[model samples]
Target: MTASALTFDEVRQARVALVGPPNSGKTTLFNTLTGGRQKTANYPGVTVERKSGRLRTPVGRSIELLDLPGSYSLRARSPDEAITRDVVLGRQEWEALPDAMVCVTDATNLGQHLRLFLELRQLGRPLILVLNMMDLAQKRGYQISIEALSRSLGIPVVTTVAMHKNGVQDLLDQIDTLLNQASVTGDGTVTTDAWVEPTPEAIRGYHQEAERLLREAVIEEGVPEQLTRKLDQVLLHPVAGPLILLGILFLMFQAVFSWAEAPMDWIDGGIASLQQWLAAHMQDGLLKSLLVDGIIAGVGGVVIFLPQILILFLFILLLEDFGYMARAAFLMDRLMSAVGLNGRAFIPLLSSFACAIPGIMAARTIAHPLDRLVTILIAPLMTCSARLPVYVLLISAFIPATTVWGGIGLQGLVMFGLYATGIIGALVVAGVLRLTVLRGGRQPLLMELPSYKWPNPANVLLGLLERARIFMRRIGTVILSVLVILWFLSTFPAPPQGATEPDIYYSFAGMIGRGLEPLLAPVGFNWQIAIALVPGLAAREVAVAALGTVYSLSGSEDAVTESLAATLAHDWTLATALALLAWYVFAPQCLATLAAVRRETNSWRWPAFMFIYLMILAYIAAFITYRVALALGGG
Candidate 1:
């Protein structure tokens, strides 16, 4: 078990930089080495930065491992790649110099992967080559002689299958030997012909060295990978690829709608029962109102989204865990490119449909600066789950859930429309931004298509649970706090004594909403909607609960006993419902996304621009929707 040792009590510490070409299993290996204790962050100024973590090997050696962004070579075109190269060469503006480097390479495609291995050597970073993906190499009818290759490269080499944790022991054994000797023996005799500085004269020399090394020791399998080639037939063909992607996306959303309904209904029933029991027992006053209307309705509004969030995460997790996402990125790059967006933007945007925060965070993976910004800016436009509650509320209220086209439901039709609107908006926005603000010439997409595999069940469960936790946390903290204050505002200026029934109209809440009504009238937002928009700033889902309470208070105080579903079904006008749904498509509903823009862009200017532009667009869209529908007589 003493796999590697540089114990404080035993010898010198090791600073290791993990260098790998893109998708060479470096990140998965980092997660395995560091567990869940790592922090992810973008480098200052540039959107993509280095991600590093501290790892203690099994033998108690303290090793600081930096997971550099995947780059094709040390000659970097992006800031992220530059930082990774600088660190390996110990040229960074911060932190102590690294002691050694681990060059992670794909064993199956060594010809394409060893380019980075040679690039790292040019940085003069004392390096060890990790022949990762050996299991995959073996599967493709190839074998590697690790000791002979190590001798040939004149550097320590270890063959590892990082995904399965196989050969990791030997990899560590090599690291310990390399690090131990660097201390006592001054640069281990282990070295590589791969080691050469990248000068105008030497860059080709290093590449030639790699080509030479690849020829003698590495054998071409004589066939393209069968599984990859087969999948790519459907996954990469321009016509077939987009169709397949659309189909997968449709199934994903379809599952979100159907699979989550039963669980949502169960939760809704539970909340209703709890509210009823509390009302029956508690004294009739603010406390009861706070628990039933404020707490149960507000908290329940957000928690009901858990099943849907989990459902979305299920597809995302399966795609990623099965190694299909890389292919997805590759396949979609062409369509995305036509829109002046990077194909890599598609994956991040798809993540945005789940929640914009992670989508924004994932944009760090895009190497192009303008592409990262464009992706981050348009990411929130994707219909997030926050938009889901609003969509479900309106669609379920106005449209029937009955099956259509012998398969899809009418309610599902609205869901599909809402999602389509988001996609169209993202593409249009990316096109505009590319032409105007983050304008740049086209960039070719270069990415590896990982082979497909069955997704791991445990990984799927853990991912779903994590997503669910984030959703609940947002509800409990931000949404709950806002709801309590809304309850305070709406509950006050109690109906005057001897006033006619259903007297919320006479309260301070009505007066405030009525004052704001004229501004929103063109958008089909009634006085009650104007009232809800104040608190809806906290979350898109909260607006659903606001409608639940304000309408209950406005029309029939007795409606506290009825489900909001029943209330909405009976009261809302179809034109009004359609207009409101359109408005939410562009509403700046989540403050968190705005806050993220500030963090990502490092200026109040960009975030402010986001809010201002979205609100203006939302108003214009909503106004046209409302007026057209009203002219058609509320169809």
Candidate 2:
């Protein structure tokens, strides 16, 4: 048999699965092999993340690499682990049995990692074991007999650093060789049996076998590593650790405001120039109004905040890569336990800070159903990147740009306060829910902390690039369509002849806003603000763009050159601005978030409850903020 004799499916594209435990550096290797050419979404009927990429081998063969979610065992517990177990055993409807598997394991924790490896070998796939972070293992004085490990496991073993480009060539070569073997011989190299659920006795037997193998293959040469211990003395102190976590979070939010200033100015200037050119060149028609006010002003208003978003993502990726995120989760465990939840809930809530969808998806990692439900319910309370534009816009307009506390910017401090408010709100909601609707026994936090290392620059860049693409994609589709529809509403039913007010005052949007004005007015929102809230239900950031489009069209002709921030500051009272900010802090601003909640819970009951509670919270918070501001003579 030869390579030329294989079928097209086997010859052209071979499906390979990358399986490993959490914090095992499996994703790092996937990124190395695929060069960030991966698509990340959810699998059918569940929110477990599906990540896959394509790679071309040296022999002109293409490989489809599936990066399975990190799991501890073949015995399914969480949805993430279930996905891994199902795909490998050919149980999933959408996935084929992988022709080959790359089982990555942390070199420093061979005892626990080998247990998973031994269980996976039962599938009898053409598997290759990758000992990632070999350099880190060597530095820690841990040694392993690679040849003996391979012999014991009856498979090929390779070592990879994963962060560097040259690290994965050996692993790739092994995959190519196994794939080639499958293509030519079509031997019993793949699992063909239906997955049988494991019994306790069988699981215990596998663990024993793993322990036996580890003793033979691994050699512990010295005392345990002291770097993490030395760092944790200060980092994990009861007083200092919490203080340090707060300081780190505060600094991260502050950097979102400070570091993004120059780039934001550049984007603002570019959008302004484009708007001016379009206004002057187009012949003052619907096209001109639509382009200048609807598209440019609407999309540009949100796009300008990309710098701030990227900065936030940069910090998150760096913290995650440097392994401090796990420590942060650990620090929050005690606080979480006090709230009647466990430390496992901390990560999902923390992840919710970036986006509720992922945060809700991340709840799948929690073992207990009640705990997962509570985490999902409170996830939206954490301010996501979408709310950054709303916060930055309101703060820049109302909060002075002056330095406070001897050096910090007042705007940044305000931004940090907004984030803290969200955190406090999430805790309160979780505490309430745990005591009421979802009360249950708390699970213990058991997680292995990865060794700290300098974040790989290439990985950071790729992470940022992926986030940028997501933002741009939203701007081009959902935002674009919403803006166009909003433009129509603000333009049509042509203003009554010789109307004294701006043209928008008589448009459909104005009528709709006025209809809701009485309801929202107590919170300091006028007709325009009310109108903006309608589009905001689609996405939180859209409210900023909606305001831009509404104000751009409503203002006098000279207002075209002014930024939205300046325009808002001139027209809106400080009381109204503060009210809006407070409202957003608890508001259910994204329908996508609600949809995610619905999918995660598999019911409309939870989503409806989520929306009602959040709305009540938003209204109360906004009313209080508005009343307090007025008392302080903010008007």
Candidate 3:
């Protein structure tokens, strides 16, 4: 086929940036417009994530919507805020000058939110002021003059309830109008000079402007709303708040174990049925072994815990949407600051519940370098989702399937204990580091407490689906590869004619595990457990699959298709099980997490130190756990 000259159509898509203070519904608005089409990646040469989505106007005009970090001002503090400032000022060489700026502001906090708008107005960009949470504002009997605000700023004003996608269409229409104006004016090129370096005088003037505009446009009937105020009395009470926070987290873990029982049973039954059918129908061969022993046993062992993982994320995402998560951080701020970190470290540490890499990247929000480093160092101890499979596997295998009063399962209690262990460990380590190395003065906690609202079901569903996709993708790729390699290591070098034990006892993995047994014996690890730990360095979740594979090969031929949990319970002592759990709680992080530390810190020194300290802690903790369990007759 002959190539014709490519017809070039001038793309008039506006480079629109959605900027606002944290928890200002900026991301909700972006998600509302983009739906499922948004992509997440890192900014060039920086670890901070860049999120963008394609938004199409009613008339079919497309615009690139950029979701900038939630920053309070153009005057940069944290790395996230710095990126937002540079991008808005057209100073980031990697980004185009925004053709339009969607300044999302909380309608209830206009006095403060409008400060950003006043600053952005100085840049001379086409600005659309988004007054979000209008429904809540109206419910509280506050009146806002959209027309007056628009006239004062000389820009279109769009009001939205981002959670429910209300007023999103209006925002899109305004964006369309701005893009048309920009194309007509031929001012698509960025104007860096328009943004002068902001000084204290300029910031004060902007705040004054914001206050004046709020006076003119906003009528507050019940200032300092009573609902949040009343709730805060109980939720923020120094003693009550921490107790309630702990109770909530404890209940979450309990729910993860109890509510997920039915689904986990279904998954487990399905796997067992499939394994039995394959074992009976297929002739014994490498193919059958790989399918039953490698794929099903390995991947299925990890996949069985999917329901529990979903439950964990469900609680987190819901709390986040309800705006209670910020409160949890606020409640923990005193404890965090005592360890030489500030309240800003709480969010990143909280993010670690999902993954440490993002949690480490999130440390960019901490202004102090030492505080940020301390947060990154301890982020791995926050019981990330990767550790969920291991926790679920051990708890299921060892803990009894019984419930305490109030219907809390014993298995869930153990799961909660594991998570709590990690949290307490992180705090303890952070405290020690602060005293010895990263000592610094306390930084003031400057944070916005968003008004509480019901979490949108659609958003919750989408968040859960996204988390499931990420987990499943890892299982299919990383877990599958690791399982295959492990299967090979356990299957090679056929047993001698008169072998007395399972063939795996003579395989490469078995020999290596035996070699490490002496070193790990004090912690109650066996040859099989030692072998699993090797591949676990790639991903913590892989340890569960590795155990499944190792035990599958170690079992007698007649029991090849037995459940991994059943096999574990039958072969492992209670002390060993608990020690293994303790080991995982403090184990050196996976290679990916270590690599992230290296990249974030710009050196091998931190990652090396992290591995050493974590390993030492893991060993000591495991040794202690093993000894105590033995004394308690768990052995």
User: Top TM-score: which candidate number?
Assistant: 2
lDDT of 1 by residue, 1-635 (tens): 36443355344457787889876878767766666555544566655545677776656677778888777777776666777766665566664567788989888778777777776665554779998878878877885666667778788888887766555877776776667766665654433334344577666776677777877786445345777678788787878887887899889988987899899889878877887788789999888888887778778766777787778778988998788788788877777898888877877888888788778867876778788888888898899887876776678667876997898878878887887887798788888988998888777787666767667565466556656666676677767777787777777778888865344465566677788899988787878788767667767877766666566542221243246657766776777888888888887887768877787778898889888878887888788888888889885
Candidate 2 C-alpha lDDT tens digits along 494-532: 878788766666888788877989999999998889988
Clash counts per candidate, in order, are 5, 0, 0
The per-model lDDT (C-alpha) reads 0.74, 0.82, 0.81
Report the lDDT tens digits of candidate 3 across residue range 166-209.
Answer: 56878877877777676668765555576766888988898899
What does the lDDT come to for candidate 2? 0.82
Q: Which runs in model 3 stand beyond 4 Å of their true positions?
A: 1-12, 91-94, 139-143, 161-166, 193-197, 218-224, 274-288, 344-367, 383-421, 493-497, 521-526, 539-581, 595-604, 624-635
- Positional deviation of residue 585's Cα in model 3 after best superposition, in angstroms: 2.9
